[model samples]
Target: MVSLVASSFMQVACAADSEGTSPNNQDKPASSWDDISDKLKVATTKGLSKLSWGLEWLGYKSGFGEQCTFVEHPSLAVRKHLQANLKAQDRAVDVLVASIEAWERTHAKDHAPLVLALTGPTGTGKTESSNLLAEALFKWTKRLDHSDKDSPSGLLVFRGEDFSDNYTNPVSQYQEQIKSRLAEHLFRCSGKALVVFDEVQKVIPHTLDVLTSAMSSNAHLTYHRGGVERRIDTADVVFLLISDIGVAKMEQLLIQYDDRRHVPATQLENDVKRALDAQWTRLQFGKMVRQVVPFLPFEPQHIVLVIQAKLDQLSEYYQGVYWKSLAFDPALAPHLSTLESMLYIERRAVVRGVDVRKVFAKYGARNVETGPLQQLKSKLMRYARPWNPEAQFTVRLMPDERTIEIVACVEARANDQDKANEDGGGGAIDTLSCVSRWQGEFT
Candidate 1:
């Protein structure tokens, strides 16, 4: 490959020299060989970079490609998604959108990546908000499209636990590994990237030194590999550092304000920043963070909305799989009641001035989805059969409250004996019978 490239460069240089010198005889000075060589070098670099980008777009893994560009203004789309999907995170959504808009407008003049520190309790829509931002910025149709072979989406995710302190390996080794991985992705994507570090509190502060340096203004990531040094620009990149640090403070602020929307953004951010600074006192990378966005704990109302959304999603999925329409009886009121009972062992917790929000905060929206919603989906898959396309199934909480029952509604005529046993004395009506019932423990 080296010889071939060299020969190609020589041929192009020779062709350019011939053309430049042959310029219709008189008035023009002869072109210098050095000038021809320089032009050829620029052309070769551009051609190779284009080729690498093209190959990557076609689903081939090119080691290095053109930098990924962002949408001109992704804040609108991001705001829309956050408002429509994420529940009870108005403050987070506002700060995130504003920060992104500002970055988009001034990124060319900025020296480093826009670093956002997302601090909150678990399952408070921190990760979900990150995903929404990635989708909007990259123009992805779905969250999973980031991994699609045809799409050259510039989103990279890292877990802090993966770089945590270990007895066997030195912290410096972990730092080097992170630097190498980040450099490779940044070079491949051409510095147009969104890098996310989830659970950053779990990582050793020393392990993130590379990130701190790369995120510094006027600093570029220098990757040394195969005897070549590649400088990856961080100006166009965005970094999201998600952690649960200072969640207690955030929760307290929320309680004090009675609502997250009422909490002063400046104060909330300062508290989170202080907590982060205290935790990472040795490294003090917290100073590099541009915005400290707080994802407040989920309230009961938010949890209910989350539960309803999950049910709707699950119902849509089951409908397609079963070839039958599924409906929830009286919506999500019963489900919420069941959830509260399962979450709180003692009813006095609510009576003793402990609001249900505490329970909602403890589990968060993610737990509700993964726990009760997952079990509900599993039960439907196991018991709900697609026997009749015309039949509709209703999911309702049984009288016992702990048991969930699936009832099938079939349209048929009832005789005298059947009427006596079934719904009163109806001649022709829909008869409902229990299809399946099971007691689910929401944990």
Candidate 2:
């Protein structure tokens, strides 16, 4: 009797276990995020997952075959914000990206309701981050692998040029375009978009006024064509407006004087308020800040970080074998060094381009044939190794003459091939000879 009862208990236990393990169990799969705000909070508080980015980049290149450039620092920050929609465990936020995340966390909703107004100096990556976020949004929806070479079909990028043609009739022209784009944006992916407006200050007031109403009132813009007018809703949109308006004011103060010197917070607030009330006359910002969103001005460190980050990104992009064959030419090494230095100086120059070569020529770069430059190029090319067609490389430089100023005469190239010196061996020739090939993209 006892053995029979124990056998029956085992069978009941097995039945219970089977029921729990069944596919129709009570717990559903963890996928769709009922509240995207929570996911954003995780992103803002914990920064982005680098592993995810690596995977995405791999997929983008290998799966999609589309060309994508990654910018570090601000670019990384932008990438995080763009991909913030994805949720996972073990998220970690970096100190460098705290402000942006904090701002996002402070304002979250079912849709991307935050309209981040990032204001900073020229190199601060405000524009970069905004662009990345928009791009990521497009990529996310297309579900195309990063490694796939095929380009996504639905991409609507709005640049200042798009609105430039209608500058004279600002409101009317802009209204038409804005309405159309908005319609398209909603028709396909209603609440799942990343819209960015760079240099918001450049936007005309009347046009800005429309954007302001659309954002604040969450109203759809209406347009009339052939005596027909239509209105749409815009409650689930993520709008990003970037500007350099406060940059000049911020940089001059920060660089000239360590921002340790503080104006009373109240005083700054009052000044901002005064500026806000005077918006109608100023007409530059269209009362956007005073009316629409917060204006966050980046500090000096932010500028330095952005510039350094851009350089690092460029270096990484150029590190591969793209230019291996050219870089390895025994005859081209010295020219590459000169080119690199020239680019650095050119960046510092007031005006850039071929004039940079003239500067080098004026410095008595010799330009005589078979001169020190030839030797240097040969030696460097040898060091670079043989040309590898499969190698990827990047070249970018500014045409600045000063690049050659510090070089010893032994390294200078000649101005002419056959021409000799005025006094024979003194080595005189054309001032502009031994031209080096230019490589890399110039901004």
Query: Considering every candidate listed, which one attains the maximal lDDT?
Result: 1
Local lDDT at 293 for model 2: 28
TM, every model: 0.71, 0.44
Indicate the TM-score of model 2. Answer: 0.44
| lDDT accuracy of residue 218 in candidate 2 | 47
**Local distance difference test values of all predictions, in order:** 0.71, 0.41
How much is the lDDT of residue 203 in candidate 1?
A: 81
lDDT tens readout by residue for model 1, 1-443? 34455666788877776766675532354435566767788868866766655665544234343446566567887788788778677888989999988987777677667999998878888888887787778733222455654432678889988877656646888887888988887876667788899998888757787776678887578879898887777887889999999977776666555455677778988888888889867545777788888887776677777777767776676564463677886644446535543252111123236663443446567667666676777776676655566567777766665556676765555456665668665444555544453444443
Clashing pairs in 1: 67-189, 67-190
Clashes of 1: 2
Cα lDDT for residue 86, model 1? 80
